[model samples]
Target: MRLSTVILPIHRWAEGQKIWRRAEDLGFHAAYTYDHLSWRSFRDGPWFGAMPTLTAAASVTQRMRLGTLVTSPNFRHPVTLAKELISLDDISGGRITLGIGAGGTGFDATALGQEPWTPRERADRFAEFVPLLDRLLTEGSVSYEGDHYSAHEARNIPGCVQRPRLPFAVAATGPRGLKLVARHGQAWVTTGDPTLYENGTPEQSVEALRGQAGKLADACAALGRDVSGIEKVLLTGFTPDRGRPLTSLDAFVDFAGRHQELGFTELVIHWPIPDSDFAADEKVFERIALEAPAQLR
Candidate 1:
């Protein structure tokens, strides 16, 4: 299984550049960041824009792939986002992946002074967003209209460096979302079950993940697509176990092993932050980055 890290966009580029470079130096397969106007606890802190941070990271890192853990329709328009993504892909020399999701009712959901969308509305917008964005990136000019979005002869010249556009790592767990994953995702992403995060056991979380994966397989089968063609990714730290996976090298190996057994091809851990939800020992984090993958193999 490949190991990756999500470096939250909380650091300024001065210090953040080193973190991005070090992720490559430590042999991480890819490095990602949250895409948000403001995230949970870091809302009042010095959070940066996901695209600019990634653009800077792309300029500094040579080999490691870079992307957003997710970019959603909360405040993004497909036409504008597609343009930025193309620029990012070209700048990164094709080393970019777009992690997308049906955004939740978090700070971003209402940050633009609009009422937050209900679960159904969020899913509806996402359904419209993904396909239109896909065409925007791949076609020379797109003119379309849908229930939630409209693109009028949107022109994308000299499109993405990655042929059909950058790979999409779609985050989903629900049936409709999974159907989109089967149709368009190059990778499937999950954060386990949010309902289980506060007071559930790791075993329960694993079972929840198992059920979700089963649903994804069913979605792919319905579409006559091979489920194995989509890379399964587990974004760690939101499960009941939280940061326990990064406590030590052995702990990480065990954590990764259990998920890998569940068919997770990639595991993404958070970069250590001193006293936040992702807080952990920096040395242990680095050790796992350097050692755990070999052990898991």
Candidate 2:
């Protein structure tokens, strides 16, 4: 399985660039940053725009693919986001991936004073968002109208550096969202069951994560899509308490092994920070970087 790391945009731009370059130097296959106006729990903390951060990251890293953890329709219009994505892909030399999800009901949802949506509404909005994005990226010009979004004469100039458009790593947990992944995504990303994580049962959470992987396979089958072509990514570094858990190198090896057994092709975890959400020492990552790959394989 490929290993990836997420560097939160809470740091300064220079520091962020250093992390991106270091991720590539450390043999990480990909690197990402969370895409949100402000994330939950850290809503009041330093948060930067994903586009600028990723664009700057692309300029620093050469080999490691870069992308947002997930972008949503909450604060983005597909037309504009499509343009920005193509530009990012061009700047990255076609090494950009798009991780997308239905907007959550936290800071991003209400940050602009928009009305809060129920779960069903969020799903519906996502349903409309993905296809429109796909069309906007692939087709030269798009004019479409839907319940949640509309694009009029939107033009994608020069298109994407990646032939059809940059690969989409869509996040999905429910059936409908999975169908969207089957239809449009080259990769699938899951955070597993938050409830299990909050309960502080890593074993149970791992089992639940495996079940979710199975569910994604079933979703692909139902849609007559080949499961092998769709990459699977799992997020494992999140903590139950708002603080990061000190993960041993051996523990990470087991975590990677379990997810690989579930057919996940990639594993993503947050970079260690001091006294923060993913709080841990940099040494933990150093150990994993040196030992986990050989052990897991």
Q: Top lDDT: which candidate number?
A: 1
lDDT of 2 at 210: 73
TM-score of each: 0.99, 0.95
Poorest stretch of ten by lDDT in candidate 2: 237-246
Model 1 residue runs over 4 Å out of place are none
TM-score of 1: 0.99
Question: Global lDDT for candidate 1?
Answer: 0.95
RMSD over all Cα atoms, model 1: 0.6
* Candidate 1 Cα deviation (angstroms), residue 54: 0.5
Candidate 2 has what TM-score? 0.95
Candidate 1, residues 1-297: lDDT per residue as tens digits?
A: 999999999897889999999999999999999999999888889999999999999999999999999999999999999999999999999999999999998999998999999999999999999999999999999999899899999999989999988999999999999999999999999999999999999999999999999999999999999999999999999999998989989988998999999999999999989889999999999999999989988
